[model samples]
Target: MPRPPYLGWLAATLVGLFAFVIRMLRLGEPGEIYFDETYYAKDAFGLRTYGVEHETVENADALLAQGNHDIWTGTGDFVVHPPMGKWMIALGDYLWGLLPFGAAMSPTGWRVAAAVVGALSVVLLVRLALRMTRSVLLAASAGLVLALDGLHFTMSRIAMVDIFLMFWVLAGFTCLVVDRDRMRERIADLTAAGQHAAGWLGFRGWRLAAGLCFGMACATKWSALFYLAAFGLLTVAWDYGARRSAGQRGVPGRWLLFDAIPAFFATVGVAFVVYLASWIGWFTSPIGWGRHWAAENVTGIWARLPEPVLAVVNPLRSLVHYHAEMMNFHTGLSSSHDYASRPWEWIIMRTPVAFFYNGDETTCGAANCSRAILAIGSPAVWWLSIAACLVMIGWWVTYRDWRAGAVLLGVAAGWLPWFTYPERTMFVFYALPMLPFLALAIVLALGLLMGRDADDPQYSPRRRIVGGVGYGVVMLLIVANFLFFYPVLSAQIIPYEQWADRMWFDTWIYGSSGSG
Candidate 1:
C-alpha cells in the first residue's frame, strides 16, 4: 500500500485525542476517592501544605471535602513511593483551587493531566512505530489498539502515578530511537564527505533530552530505574552495531571505550541529577522533616563540609534516608488483599480490580444495580499481543531483526524485573509501561500476516481471500468485545445481570480480573 506522507501521524493524533477526551469527560464525577487515590491524592495535598507528607485524621476524606484543609498533624507520613508523582497530582489542586467546584478536590482537574499525557503517549507510540516499521498502516494500527485498550483508557482517566511513569519512559525511549537515526545519518554524511575517521560523535543533544525524560520517569516511580538501565545497555549495543555495520574492526571494545562509558555518565548521571532536583521544594523548606539532620548531627562529615556545601549535601542525605524507609515498606508489604495478584496472571488479565462500584436499584432501574470502573485489559488487544510476542521471538531468533530486539528490550525492562519480587506486593497496573511495546508487537505480527506487497502475486487467490476474511473477523471481534465491556470500564450504571454477563468469568466478578 502507498503511504500517505504525514497524514498517518495526523490521523493517529486525532484518534488519540478522541480517546483522551473520552477519558477526561465526567472525570470528576463519583466524588469520593477511588481505590488507591485515597492514599495518593491526600498525600499530594499534604505535600503541598507541608514540605513532607503529613499524617491525616481518621475519616480525613470526608473532613477535607468540607473545606477543612488542616488535616495534617505535623507528623511525617510513611509513603512508599517518591514525591514527584504526588507533586503532579498537587499541580491540579494548585490550579483548580485547593477544593474546586466544592465537590471534593476536582477529580476532573487531577485526572486531566494524566489524560493529556496518555494522549501524547499514543502519538509518540504511533511515530515510534512508524519509524521502526516504515509502515504507516502498522503505526496507525498500533496507536488504535493502545487508544482502545481498557487498561490504558482507565489509567488515563484516573489520578495515578503509573500514567506519568508510562509517559516519561516512553518519551525517553522515543528520544533514544530518534537519537539512533540521527547518529546514523550524521555518520553517513561525514563518511560521504571524507572529513574524519569513525570514532566519537560530538555532543548528542537528543541523548541529553532522553536523559531528562529518563529522569522524569524515575521521579514518577523507581520502577523507571529498570528502563534507564536497559536503555543504557541498548544504546551501547546500538553504537557497537553501528560501528560494525560501517566496517569498523573491534567495534565492541571501541564502543566500550568511547561510547558506553560516556553514555553511562551522560544518561545515568544526568538522570540522578534531575531526580534529585525534583526535591528542591522539600530541600529548601525549613519545616521539612529531617531538614535539620545536618544541624542536629554537626560532628559528622556533613559538619566538616563548608556551610554552603552542607546546605546542598544535607538535603540529599535526608532524601536518601527517606528513600530507604520507602524501600523497606515496599519490600516488607505482604498484607493479603482480595485483589492482589501474581505477575503470571497479569498477561491474561485473570483478575481486574474494581476501582469504583456504586449502584442502587433505584438508580440502576433493575432488580440489582451495578456501576463500576474496572481496571481490565481488552482481551483482544492483550491476548493477541501475547501471540504477537511469540512471533517476535521467532523473528528475532530466526532472522535476527534489530526491531524485534528493541521491542523485546522494552518488554523485558518493564516486565522481567517484576518476577524478582514475586513475594513482594505488586499490582497489574505496573504493566502499564510495557503496554506500548505490546501494541507494537501486535502491529508487527499483523504486518507478517498481511505479507509483503512483493509477494502478493505469488499467493493463490483462495489463500488471499481466506487471509483477508480472517483478519476482518478478528478486528470485528475485538471491536465487539470492547463495546460489550465499555459500561463496566467507564463506570456506567447498568443492571447487575448485564454487568455479570459482561464479566465473562467468575474471576472478574470476584475482583480477580488482573487486567490493570
Candidate 2:
C-alpha cells in the first residue's frame, strides 16, 4: 500500500555492526582450547599446513599453548565433518598468521571467522524480516533479538563450525525468500496485464544464488541437507500456487514441466556441483583419507569398466565410499557425553554445554572465583518463541500465511531430524540454526497483533499500542536475561557464589563448582 521501509536497511546495518563488535570483543579470553575447539582449531591448523587435516603430535593442545607451531605428525586425520567448515576456520589462520604474535594456534586467529559469520547472520535475518513484514522496526527487533540470544552469542565467539553452518543455512533461506517475492511479482503483473500464461519468466537469479548458499551450507555440515529438501519443496509449492492463481491451466503439469524441472537444475544440480567443488582441497591433497580407495580396491562392477572409464570414475567412486563411511559413523555414534541433550530438552534450555571452565585463573577479586563459557540460551526468548510459534501455526492453518508456514518448516527441518536419531549424542549448540526462525516467529506474531500499519486507512492504534508494548517488554526481558548470563557466556571471571547463584538447576552446571 506504500513505499517499502528502506530505513530498515540502515537499522540492519547498525544492528549487524553492533553484533560483530560485541562478538569479537574479549573473544580470546581464557586463551586456550575449550570443548570442541580442541578438535576444530587444531584441525584448521592442520588443513592450513597440509591441505587436509593432519594428525598432530601427542598433547598437541598443550604444545600449542606453549607457542609451538610445529605440532604436525605428518599424517592425515580421519575427521567426520566435511572440509568446508575447517577451511573457513583455516581462513582466519591464513590471514591472522601474517601478523606478528598472531598464528593458527592463537584462539583469536581461528575464532575470528565464527564471530564474523555469526554477526552477518544477524544482518541477513534483519533484511529478511524487513522483506517479510514491510516494517522497519520489527526487522531491527528481529536482528536485536538474534544478537541478544545467548546461544548465538556463545557459538559466534567459538571456533566451532556450527556458526558457519547456521550462517549459510540462513543465507540459502534468505535467497529463496527473495526469489519468491520476485517470481510472485512477475506472475501477478503478467496476469493483470492479460498474459495468463507467462512461460519461463526469464532466469531466476535469486534461486540460483540460493543453490550456492545451500551448497556452502551442506559443505559446512551434512545436516543442511534437511533444510535444502524442505526449502526446495517450499519453493515448488509456491510455484504451483502462483501459476494456479494466475489462471494458468494445468497448474500441476505446468509446474512439473517448467518450474519443477528448472528448479531441480537450479538448486539440486547446482548444489551438487558446489558440494563437489568444496572438496577440491581433499581431492587434490595426496594424503586425504580414502582418496585412493577406488584405485586400491577395484572389484565387481568396477572391474567390468574399461581402463579409460575407470580412470575417470575413480575419484567419484572414492568420494562415494568416503560418504558411506561418514554416514555409518554418524548413524552409529552413541558416545556418552555429559551435556548431551535430546531435541526436546534443547527447546526448553534443560542442559547447557559448558564450553570452557577454570577456577585457577586468578582475576576475580574473591578467594573463590569461577570463569566459564556456557552455551545456554536466554529462557525468556526461547519460552516466548514457543508461544509465538504456536500463534504462527494457527495463522498458517487458518489463512495459509506463507511466512508462517516457512518459519514453521524451517524450525521443523532444523529440529525434527534429530528426533529420528534419539540415540545420537547431541549438544545445545546443534539447535543454534533454529534460533533465527524462532526470532522471526516472534516478529511475525507481533505483526499479526498490530494488524495494519499506522498509515493504513483502517489501522488500529489500540492494537499497535498493545503489540508495541508487548514487544518492548519481551525485548527488555531478553536483554536482561542475556546480561545476567553474560559473565558465564563470555567466560568472565566472577565469584564462585555468583556462578552458583546463576545456576537455577543442577543440570545447568556442566562441571564441578570448584572453589577458587
Candidate 3:
C-alpha cells in the first residue's frame, strides 16, 4: 500500500490526544494521595516552600490543607533521586495551590503533566517508526499499540518521575535519529559534488538538542544515564556506517576524528551543563542546605580557587553531597513491601503496585465494594513483545538490519541495567522506558508477517491474510483486556467479586483485602 502523506501524522496525533483525554477524564476521583504520591507530593511541596526539600510533620497532608504551608522549614530533607522531578511536581503545586481536599493534591493536578508527556511520546514514537520503516501503517500501528497498552496508560495517570524520564530519553532518541538521516543526506551531497572529505558536519544543532533532552532525562531519574551511554555509542556508529555507505574506505579513523570526538562534547558535556542548570532554584537560594558550604570552607583546595571558580565549585560540591545521600537511600531500600517487585518479574506484571483502593459496599452502593487503580501491563502487548524481541535478535544478528539494531539498543538501554541490581526492590512501573521499544518490536514483527516482495509470490496472498487476521486478533485482545480491567484502573466503584477476579495472583493482595 502506498503511504498517505501527512495522514499518518494526523492519525497518530489524534490517537495520542484521545489517549490523553482518556487518562485525564475524572482523574481527580481518588481525592487522596495514592501510593508513593504521599512521599513525592509532600517532597514537592517542601521543595517549593524551602528551596530544598524539608521534612513534613506527621499527617502532613492534613496540615498542608489547613493552610500550614510552613510544614518544611529551612533544613534539607534526605531524598532518593534528584530534585528535577520533584521540581516538576512542585510546578503543579505552585499553579494549583496546596489544598489537600482541593485539586492541588488531587490525582488530576499531580498527574496532568505526566499524562501530557506520555501523549506526546506516542506522537514521537509514530514519527520515529515511520522514519525507520518508511511505512505509515507500521508507524500508526506502533503508536496504536502503545496508546492501548495498560501500563503506559497507568503510568501516565500517576505523578511519577518515570514517565518524564521516558519522555526525555525517547525525545533524545528521536533527535539522534534525525541527526543520522541529516548526516547521511549531507554526506551523499558532498560525495556527489566530488568532495573527498566533509569535515566536522558543522555545528550539529540536532545532536546538541538531543544532549539537552538526555540531560533532562537524567535529571528526572538516574536510570536515564544508561540511555545516555548507549545513544552516545549508537550515534557514533551511525556516523561510521554513513561514511562507509558513501564509499569512504577509512570510515573508522575518520568517524573517530570527525564524529566521536566532537560527539563527546556535544552529548556528554552539554548534558552535564543542562543537568546542573536544572538545580538553579536550589543553587541560587541562600536558604537551601549546603548553599553556604563552600563559602564557609575558605581554608582548603576549594578556598584556593578564584572567586569565580569557587562560585561554580560550591554548587557542584553541594550537589555531589546530596547525590551521595540519595544513592545510599536507594541501595539500602530493603524493607519488604507487599507490592515491591524484582526486575525479573516486571515484564509479567507480577506484584503490580496499587495506586489506590477503597472498599465499602455501602459507599460504593454495590453488592460487593471495589474501587482501585493498579499498575498492570497489557498482557497481549507485553507477551507478544517478548516474542518479537527474540525475532529482533535473529534479524539483527543474521541480516544486520539497522532497524533491528535500533530496537535492541532501545530495549537494552532502558532494561538490562536493572538486572544488575536484582536484589534491589523495583516495580513494574520502572519498565516505562522500555515500553516504546517493545511496541516498536511488535510492529517490526507484524511487518515481517506481512512478508517482503522478494518472498514466494504464490504464498504472498495467504501470508497477508494470516498476518491481518493475527494482527486483528491481537488488537482486539489487547483492547478487550484493557476494557476488562479499566474499572479497577480508573478507580470506578465495582463489586468486590469483580475486583477479586482481576487479581490474577495471591501476591497482588496486600493483606488488607486491597487489590494492588
Candidate 4:
C-alpha cells in the first residue's frame, strides 16, 4: 500500500534516453540493404513516391543506392503485408525527403522512424512494468532488459514493420493494464457506496484506446489479429472479475449481456473498422491486386444486388479474396533459406537470422574479419526468460497470479501461433514482438525472489540479503551477455575468432560464415 517512488519516472526516462542514443548511433551503417529491409525499405520508398507500392527493377537496391530513385514501374506492387507499416516507414522518408525519386536517398533517414518507435517501446515497457508491480526498481529493470535484448535492438535499427507492430502491441497492452486498475478502483468505490449493480462502467476511454492500438497493430500485420482477439477476451474477463469482486449478483450473466457485448463493440468492432480504414489507399487504387476480382465475379447472385450496393460490397469481397491469396502465400511459404529456423528453436535462440555480413580482411582489419548484423538474442536474458516463463506458468496455475497470466497470454498470442505453422519458414527475428513480455516474465520471477518491499513489515532482513544479492548477480549477467553480443548485433567488425567466440552454438555458425 506504500506510494511508489516518483523517481521511477526519472529512472525510466533515463533508460529511454540511453536506449534512444544507442539505437540512433550509426543506424545507417553497413550502408547496403540487409535481409527483409529489402522489402520494407523499398515498399516504404515506393509508397512515398507513388502513394502505393510499385514494382521495381531487379537491381533496385543497386540503383537506389546511387540516388537514381526513379525505380518504380508505376503499377501497384502485390505486397502481402498491409500498407500501414510501410506508411509508418514512409513517415521518416516524408520528413527527410528520401523518397525513391528524390535527388538523394538516405537509408538512415528511412530507418529513423523505426529507431524512434523502438526506443519509445522501451519507455512504454518501463511504465507498464511500474504500473503492473508498483516497483520503480523493477520497472527500470524491465526497461534495461528490453534495451539490452539483441533481437529488439536489431529490429529497432532497421526499416521494419515488426518494431512498429511491437510499439502498437505494447501500447494496447498498456492501455488494458491501466483499464484493469481503473475498473478495480471503480468497483471498490461502488461497493463501498452500496451500489453493487452499477449498470455500466460508463465511457471506458482506456479500453477504447486499447482497441485503437489493436487496430493499428493489425494494419501493420495480420498476425496482430491474434493479439487483438486474445486481449479482447482478456479485457472482458477482467471486467467480469471486477464486477464479481464488487459483490454484484448474477455477475456472469450481467457481464455477458452488458459488459461482454459492449467490449466486443469497443475493442473488436473498433479494431475491425480501423483495419478496413488501413486499406483506403488499396481500395482507391485500380492497380491493387484483386481490385477487379469482384467485378469479374459479379455474375450469379451478385447481379440481383443494386449497382451502388455492389460497388461498396464488391471491393470488400475483393479485399477478402486478396487476403485469402496472401494467406495461401504465407501458409505455403516453405522455401529453404540459409537462415530459416523452426518455431521450436526460437525460444532457445537457435538458428538466428543474419541480417548482414561482410568478411573482407582489408575493411575489417584482420586476416579473417567479420562484420555482421545477426538477430540473435542475449543468451542470459532469453534463456533466463524461458525459465521465468516456466516458473510463471506454475505460479499462475497454482495461485492464479493475474500478472503472470497476462504475460503468458501475450507469449501465447505471439509465440504459440507459430507452432501451428511449423513448416512455414519462420525466423528468430519474428520473436521480437514477444520479447517485452518475456522480459516481464523474468522481472516477475525476480520480484518473487525479492519478496515484498522492505517497507512492508512482513519483509524479512535475511531473505532480503539473499534476494538482493541474487537479483544483482542476474542483472550483471544479463548486462555482460548483452555487451558480449553487441558487436554481432550491431554489425561491428571483429576478428573471425572473436566472432566465432560469440557463436555459442553450431546454429550460430551463420554469424561466422556470412552465408546466412
Best by TM-score: 2
Error of 1 at 481 (Å): 2.1
Candidate 4 local lDDT, 42-160, one digit each (tens): 98887777777778889998997787878888577788888899898888767656445432247787788888888899999999999988888899999999999889999889888
Worst 10 residues of 2 by lDDT: 507-516
- For 1-516, candidate 3 gives per-residue lDDT tens digits of 225667777867887888888887877667667778777777777677767767667777776557455666546666677778778777865665554544564456677677777888889898888888777778888888888888888878777778788888999999999998899889989899987566667678899999999999888898999999999999999998888888876777788999999998999988988898877877766666566765776676766789898877777787777777679878877766667787767777666777788886456666779888888888888888889999999999999998899989999888889888866877788888989999999999888887654345555877888888877777788789888888888888888988989887776767222454
Ranking by lDDT: 2, 4, 3, 1
- Candidate 2 per-residue C-alpha lDDT over 305-414 given as tens digits, one digit per residue, 9 for 90 to 100: 99999988998898899999999999999988788888998888888888888888667888899998888888888989999999999999999999999999999999
lDDT of 1 by residue, 297-332 (tens): 767566678989877676777777778777888888
Clashing pairs in 2: none
Which residue pairs does candidate 3 place in steric collision? Answer: 368-496
Worst 10 residues of 1 by lDDT: 97-106
All predictions: root-mean-square deviation over Cα? 3.2, 2.3, 3.3, 2.5
Q: Which ranges of candidate 2 are over 4 A from the true structure?
A: 1-6, 99-104, 510-516
Global lDDT scores for all candidate models: 0.79, 0.88, 0.80, 0.86
Q: Which residue runs does candidate 4 get wrong by more than 4 Å?
A: 1-6, 98-104, 511-516
